[model samples]
Each structure stands twice: as structure tokens, then as C-alpha cells.
Target: MIPRLKAWWRMFDTFTQRCLAVSVVLAIVASACLVQLVNVQLLDGRTTAEAATNSRTSKVTLSAKRGRILDTNGTVLAQSVERYNIIGVPDAATSFTPVTCGSKQAKSLGYCHAIDDKPVGATGAAAVARLLAPLLGMDAMELGAKLNGTNQYVVLKKEVTPQVKREIDKLNLGGIVYGELSSERVYAENTLIGALLGGVDDEGKGASGLESSLDDELAGTDGYTVYQRGNGGEVIPGTVTKTQEATDGKDVSLTIDADVDWYVKKVLSEGVSAQHAQWGVAVVQDVQTGEIIALEDSDSIQAGSDEAKLGSSRAVSQTFEPGSVGKIPALAAIMQSGVKITDQFTIPYEMEKDGQKFHDASSHGAEHWTLAGILQNSSNVGMITAAANVTNQQRYDMLCKFGIGQSTGLNLPGESNGVLTSPESWDTRSKETVLFGQGYTVNALQLTRAVSVIATGGINRQQSLIKSVSTSNGKQTSKLNTSATRVIDENTANEIKNAMESVADRWNKVINVSGYRIAMKTGTAEVAGDSGALTSIVADTVGFLPADNPRFVVTVVMKDPAGVHGGTTAGKVFAQIGEFLMQKYDVPNSAERTDAIPVEW
Candidate 1:
């Protein structure tokens, strides 16, 4: 009886061990299921939703219309034109079988035979290519190969006509697609202001000029659309889920006058060609506001010609020795420092200082001349002698105040600041040479504005090219006012103006207008070669019209002219431009005619 009872206990213990093992396996499997359920419900819920949406939804980018660039009088310089892009998606169509069972032979052959679908197959590609070849001026064989390729997307042409796009849409060809993009740039005046307006790149971004500088303001925001796509990545009908509208850019108005600009360009081109010079620049500015009325350069940048690429505007980019024009600013500085404006000097043919020689344009024995006489004669030696009264630091300060050694604030790309040596860097001869308009450089724009100080009553106004900005709602958003700074006393500026009147009188043989009293100064700068030897000359003339009551400041600069003096080459151009401005703007002649200032005091 005891042995039987022990066997029963052993059997019960073995059964309990087996039951515990099964329970442990079930617990492990239940724990894994709970962990996976938590991950799917909480950890990656958003990611899963996004994946599902991406599988069916497609995003399409929308292009915004670029702004128009206009002149001061609402003349459009650059604008956007409507255009389209021709596209082809080789795999946009699905596989299908074509059948023709209406014929008796097809009915007798038991049933309609399944033929290969011509819309998406090689046969379809060839047929479509042949149909579009004549309409699109494309090679049939090449287009057929493209249509038969494995590429999912391809652009066949850009800047396509709207009519052609409409014709293509009517075909209802499979795997063929086209869309419109309104980012193409069009020049309204065609190369008249190409350099200033700049050109657009292939991607419709501004490449240069004001277009590049104000790209942000000129380029509006682009929007996008989200829609459902079919299996072939084509937009499904009535499945547009979301869309955002595009905005157009603002309109930019420049300070230039189109009519005046055209006239100036004509005169400048003729002047450059007549002189057979390297280049030329002509600028006309309103001294009071510092608004550039008319500006032109020798390089005529054509609209669509890639061969004659527009070079930099030499008016503000190229720098050269200021020559006699430097004397105007020098004279202004000396007079502002209380030097006797009427002080007399004995100017000789040549004078030497620190082993360096300075001379007048012509050989004149020591002759008596006043400060005004020195400017009228453009005497280098006399200028150096007169400038000796002022310190080197004083001279440098005058140049700085006149806007030399810095940009003119024209807001154009690649503007150069004329070179003005620091006072500390001046040597024994540096001051003398610089005083006579040597050892320093200035571009045409800088030089013209510097001289405008005399015309603007001793105030320097910042030069500007932008006039205003307008929005699409036809509201004037902003109008810019050029900054003004007092550089010299009004009395001193008038005194220099009087002296410039005499300078213009001396060159009357070449630059005198019929009924206008013009105040002018001529500069003949010796152009030095790479080896520091004089090779050519730059002739320049800068001044204001109606000397008694100045209105417009006209400046003409010609490089490497056939003639040596500004009075002969640039002065004529200046006179011509002055006459045109007087007539174009209807500027009246001076109320009273004044006696000419003495050339030889």
C-alpha cells in the first residue's frame, strides 16, 4: 500500500512541471504581441500616415510671374511674356490590347484578335512622332527614339508658343504632356537698356544689372499644388487635394528718361566712333536731386545677340587719371580753406619738384595768371602752385568730401570708387602731382558728380538710378529721395562756378551753344601704359548748362581719342548733348547775359 501511494505522488509532480513549462511559453508570446501593438499605435503612427499619403498624392510646383522694369515715364524696359514647355513621359500610359472585330475576316477568325496597343508601344511612339514632326519642326526618327525610351519624364522644348501647346493638347496622345511656365523674360525696348535691365538665365533667374540686384523684389513667390496621381504618375481627374496660388512681382521704375536716354546713346555712339577711341561715356544729371536724366556707354548691348555681349558700363566702372578735371575739386578745396580766390601766380612752361616735372599743355613762358586764369587755361604748374597753400591732409579731405575714393551710390553693380591717395601715403611729389590732377584716378560718373558739387550750391547729393517701386494693385509703394550732405559753403561753390564760367568761355571756339551761357571744364589726361610710360590720352569735359542759373550737368569722357585736348574732342560732344537737352527739356536761356571772365588776369 505504501509503494502504490509514492508512485501516485511522483506522477502528479511530473504533470505539474509540464503544465508550468506550457504557461511560460504562452506568457513570452503575449509580451511580444503587446510590444508590437504599442509601437504601431503610438511610436510610428504619424510616419505610417505620411507613407500612405505619399503613395497616392503628388506635388506640382507653380511658377510666379516676374515683374516689369520701367523707366521714369512708365516706359517698360523688361517684362515677362507667356510661354509653355513641351513635355513627354514615355511610361505615362498603361499596357492594353487593341482589337478590331467589325471586319468579316476578324469575325470569321472565331473572335476579335488581341493586337498590341499602338498608343504606348513602339508602334504608337513612331506614329505619334511622325504626326508631331511637321508641327513641331522635330526629327521624326529622333523623337520616336525619345518617345520609346525608358525615361519617365522628358522636356522636348521650352518657350513654346501657346498655339502649339493647344494643338498638341487636342491630339490626346498617350505618354505626351505639356504645361505652361510664365517666367520667360522679354525686353520691351530691345537692347536699349539691356545692360541696365540685365538678362534672365535658363532657369528664369536674373543674370546681371538691376535685374540681379533687385531679384528678390522683382521675383514674386511661387506656390504649389498637391493632387492624386494614377499608377503611371499622371494627375487623376477631379483628384486635386490642395493648391496654393502664385503672386506677381512688383514694378520697378528707374530714374532714366527713355527719350533722353535714346538721344544720349545715339550721340555717345557717334562720338566714340568718330574719335576711333577705345570707348566713351556720356552722362547728364540733375544737380539738385542727383537724378541721372540720361546715361549711355559705347558698348551697345543687343537684346538677343549672344556674340556682342555687353561689357561693363565704362561710365562708372573704368577709372583713369582725373587730369584737369581734378583741378575743379582742388580749387574748391583751396577756396573753402580761405585761400585768396583772386590770388595771382606766375605760371611757367615747366616746373620741377623732387626730381619730377610738371608742365602746362602748351609752352607758355612765365606769365601772370590769377586763380581763375589757371583753371581757364588748365595750367598744371599754376594749379600746383595754388594748391601749395593747402596742406596734404586738407587736399585729401577735399577729395573725400567730393565723393572720390568711394562709390557714387548709383545702386548699380560693379561701380568703382575713384582712387584718392591717403594723406599719410603722400610723398614729396605726390601732393604736387595730385594737385594738378595726376597720380589719382576717377571714373566718369564719379568725376561728373564731383563737378556737380559746384552746380548744386556746395551740397553733394547721392546719385540714384531707381526712381520708384509700384505694386500690382496700381498703388505707388515707395519713392526714393537721394541723400544730400553739405560739403562746402554756398559762397565757395558760387565762386568756383564763376571760375568755371571763364573756363567755358576759353573753350567757346568748340563748345559754345548758340543762346546759352554754359559753365564747363576740360580735362586732357595722359594715359600711362603698363610699363609706366605715357601711351595715349583721355579727353573729358564736364560742366553745367545756362551758367548763370545752372540746370543740367553734362559730362563726356572719351578714351584714347585721336585728338589730345578735351576742348577738341569731348567738348564738342558735351556741347552737342547740351544743345539737345536744352531743346528736349525746354530749358529757357539765361535771363541776362554776363560778361566773360578774364582768361588772363
Candidate 2:
């Protein structure tokens, strides 16, 4: 009976141990399930499929429209427009068979015809190539080969018209997509201000000209977006979000008047066409404000382009030896040094120096002449004689003070400070030649503005493109000011004005309208070759209308053509533009003509 009891106890103990082992197993299984549930619901989600889509669902950035450029009167010069990019997702079309999609095919059906409903067999790359050729304007075979490339997302074309794009969208081509873009730096004037405004990059970023110079002001801040994405990089509509907003560029208003700019370009274009001249330029400035109203330039024709703003302001960038137009400033520099207008100087018939011949524009007498007569006749010898009274360094200094051989720092591209040899670099011939518009180079803008200083009460203010910028918050920040710089004295200023009037009255004889006193100067300079031989004369006529108290400083430089004379070509251009301004603006006539008698037809 005892043995039987022991056996039963053993059985019961074994049963209890077995039960505990089973319970431990069940507990382990339950813990794992709970942990997995927490991970999916709170800590993280499924990683392979859903997590991958989340990871790849990156936030894409968008660009805002760049600000428009307008003329002083609010005419559009440059602006930005909406553009787009067509993207493709090669995986979207399930019916597009792998063989037809430029990929190796599997014999089984599910893989190839799964994406799109399109048929699979005989219609391979060749047939699809032909269909894409005209639509894409691409070679069928080449495009097919590219479609075979590894990159699934690719750019098809750019600057596509919206009409064609709309038609394409209607076709409902599977796996194809579209994204936003911008066609920026669009010149409304279409090459009118091309060289001046310059071009932007594919991202609508500034590259040159005013666009580049003022890029900081004109360009807006770039923005970004950050959000959670699925494992496949696909955006999760419910979870993904955008953070910062993109800022658009600022609109800029120029000091330039579009009407005046149009006139300048039109007249210069006609001049270039008729004369068959290499190129030409006309610059207009406000004498009192130092504002560049118009700058028209031209270059070699591009066979088919019909743009006005060409040549890139050979006016501001070019620096050739200005033949005679330089005479006014040179002579003015001397007279201001106390050389009296009444002081007389006897000049030589032909001054022989350093194995070089120095002849006047014409043969003149070796007679005694006053300062006024010397300038009226534009006597080379007389100028040399007068310049002799001033030291070499003195003349150079005066030129420096006048802003020659120095950068104007104007807000423009391709500006040349020009060449000015110091006294140490000056040769005897150079010294003599410089006396009559040789041995040095000066740009059109600088020359005109130098005269402008004399016209605008001795203040040489810096030049600018942007007049003022009005912030989105309504505050206006002026770019340049009346007190930018002061370069000359008022007395010397008046004397120069007097001297300019003397030249116009005596030689150029500009049209003297009633109640208006005109001050003017005529300059005819011959361009020189590498051998220092005369190439062709560049005629330049620069004058200000209502000269007694100057208003418009018009300088015209007509490049090489047959009848090369500055007074004729540039003078005529000035007359037409001046007449247009006077009539269009209705600028009142000068107070009773105190300077000279009117020109009778």
C-alpha cells in the first residue's frame, strides 16, 4: 500500500512541473506580441514596405515668381512667367511590357502587362519611336535609347508652350507627370535692355548686368520643406507637411525713361542700317540729376535678330582715342588753371617733335589768337601752346580730378575705366597728341558725365539704375543720392559752361530756339591702328539743349562709315531726339535768349 502511494505522488509532481513549463512558454509568446503591437502603433511602423515609402516621401520645394522690372513710367522691361517641367514615372504603366519598355522580358505575363493595359508583342521600340519623334521633336531611335537609360525620372524638354503641354496632358500617357517651373529674366523689350539687364540661370538666378549687380536686392530667399515620408519616398498625404514659405524677388524701378530709351535706340538703329557703320551709341543724361536717361548701343547683326539694345554700350565699355570731342574738357582744364580766355598765344605752322609730324585738322596761320579764338578754331598748335603753360603732372591731375582714368563705379556691367598714362609714362609725342584728343582713351558715359558735372552746378554724382525700392512693408529705400560725390568747384564749373557755349556758338552753331540758350561742343576723333596710323575717323557730336542753363547732355558716337564726321551724324541724332523730348514733355522754353541770336533757316 505504501509503494502505491509513492507512485501516485510522483505522478502528481511530474504533472505540476509539466504545467509550469507550458505556462512559461505561453507567457513568452504573449510578451513578444505586445512588444510588436507597441512598436507598430507608437514607437515605429512596419519598416520594409511602409517604412520605405515613408523614408522616400521627401518634401519638394517650389519657387516663387521673380519680381518684374519696370521703367520709370511703369512700363514693363523685364518680368517672370510661369513655366513647367514634365516628369515621368516609368513604373506606373503596368501594361507597358518589359520588352516594350526597353527592358528584358520574362515569359510569364504578370510582370510585363501588369502596369498598363497597352498590348505587349510586335509593337516594340521601333513603333513607339516613330510616335514619339514628332511629338518630342527628337530622333526616334535616339530617344528610345535614352528611354532605356537607368534614370527613370528625366527632363524631356524646356520652355515648352502651354498649348502643347495641355495637349500632352490630355493624352493621359501613364507614368508621365508634370512639375512647376519659372521662365524668369524675360525681357519685355526683348533685347532692348538685353546687354544691360543680362540673363538669369535655369533656376531663374541672375548671371550678369543689372541682374547680377543688384542680385542681392532682386533675388529672394530660397526656402525648404521637411516632413516624414514612407519607405518608397512617396509623400504621405496625411503626415507630410511644408514648413518655411519661399520669398519672391523684389521689383525694381529704374531712373531711365522708356520713351527716351526707345527714341535713342530707334534713331541709332536707323543710323547703323543706313550708314552701314560697324556700330554706334547715343547716351542721354539729366544734367542736374546725374541720371542716365538713355543709353543706346549696337553691334554686328545676328542675321535674324531685330533687337534695339545692342552693342553693349561701346559708350561705357569702349575707350578709344576720342579725336576732338575731348577738346572741350582739355581746354576747360587749362582755362580753369587761370589761363585767361583773352590771353593770346602765337602758334607754330607745324611743330616738329620726336620724329613725328603734328598737323592741325587743317592748315592754319601762325597768328596771335585769344583763348576764345583758339578754341573756336580748335587749333592743335594753339592748344599745345596753351597746354605748355600747364605742367605735365598738373594736366594729369586735372584729368584725374575730372574723373578720367578712374572708375565711375556706375551700376552697370562691362564698364572700362579707360587708359590714362601718368606723367612718367608720357612721351613727347603723347604729350603733344593728348593736347588735341590723342594718346589716351575715354568712354562715352564718362565723357558725357564729366560735362554733366560742369552743367549740373559742379556736383558729380554717382550714376544708378534703381531709383528707389519700396519694401512689402511699405518702406522706401533710396539707392543713390544727390550727395554721393562732389568732384569740381562751382567757379570752374561756370567757366566750363561758358567755354562750351563759345564752341557751339562759333563752330557747331546748334539750333538756337527762341527763349533758350544752347551750349554745345563738336568733337571729331580719328581711330588709330596698332601701328599708330589713322584707321577711320569716329565722329562724335556732344551738345546740351538750352545750353545756357543745360538740361539734356546728348553724346553721339557714330562708328566707322563713309561720311565719318561727328558733327554731321551725332549732331543730327541729337536734333531729332531733342525735338522729340521738347515736344513730348512740353519743357518750357528758356527765359528770353540771353546768349545768342536764333538760327534762321
Q: Lowest summed-lDDT stretch of 10 residues in model 1?
A: 113-122
1-601 in candidate 1: lDDT tens per residue? Answer: 9999768657767779688778899999999998988897799888888787787786777888888888889988788888887777665422312224466754675434222322323345565565566658889788777777566567777887778878776554533555556546877553465565666677777666777777887888888899977763568899798899888788999888888888888887888889887888889898767888877777778543342224445565778887888898899877766776677888898988778887788987888888888888888888887877788888998988988887877667666786787889988887887776788888878888898999998988888778888889988865566678889989788878888988887788888888898888888888886577898788899999888888889989888888767888888889988999889878887755555445465
Off by over 4 Å in 1: 1-56, 93-122, 229-238, 303-311, 530-532, 595-597
lDDT of 2: 0.65
Per-residue C-alpha lDDT of model 2 across residues 149-250, encoded as one tens digit per residue: 445466656665566567555433434334435453457543465567665666666666666666777777766676664433344577646677778777
TM-score for predicted model 1 compared with the true structure: 0.84
- lDDT (Cα, 0-100) at 531 in candidate 1: 77
Q: Root-mean-square deviation of each candidate, in angstroms?
A: 8.5, 7.4
Error of 1 at 259 (Å): 1.2
Q: Count clashing residue pairs per candidate.
A: 0, 28
